[model samples]
Target: MIEMKEVHLIAKLADLQEVDYHNTLVLHALIELLVEKGLLTHEELTAKAHALDSQLSFQLDLASKLSETIQNRHTQIKPIS
Candidate 1:
């Protein structure tokens, strides 16, 4: 049998999905208006998004490498008596 807590969680998930759908619709409408008004071009938006994604990926990779280096260094340290 489904518990009351499980029912509440399911309702919350549905609410989140509705909110996400609404936000997506708003974003699409804003993008369409911007393009329609000639304030921005599709190519420009695509290029900027791609650039941002590339930068984020590079930063994440650098952070992962730095974290691994820190862990390795910590493991290599010797304790003082």
Candidate 2:
């Protein structure tokens, strides 16, 4: 069900994730432009990024706990004859 455009966008985002300091400077410039246009505030951008980091951390911790519980439960299962 994935469209070509969506796949391309995902690839572009992945590339962006791997960007180095120079690319970060370019992105910072774009962020500044957006701020200048009143499209987004610096505080709002940073706040959302922090919130996302916190949310992902919680999800990762929960996933680790769940994985451990699943492994322990699996070990307790009896094989069928």
Give all candidates' CA lDDT scores. Answer: 0.99, 0.95
Model 1 Cα lDDT, one tens digit per residue, 1-81:
999999999999999999999999999999999999999999999999999999999999999999999999999999998
- lDDT at position 73, candidate 2: 100
Q: Write the per-residue lDDT of candidate 2 for residues 1-81, one digit (tens) a residue.
A: 999999999999888777866688999999999999999999999999999999999999999999999999999999999
Q: Model 2, residue 55: what's the lDDT?
A: 100
Superposed by TM-score, candidate 1 places the C-alpha of residue 6 at a distance from the truth, in angstroms, of: 5.7
Native RMSD of candidate 2 (Å)? 8.9
lDDT of 1: 0.99
Model 2 score (lDDT): 0.95
**Model 2 — which ten-residue stretch has the worst lDDT?**
13-22
State TM-scores per candidate. 0.75, 0.59
RMSD of each: 2.4, 8.9
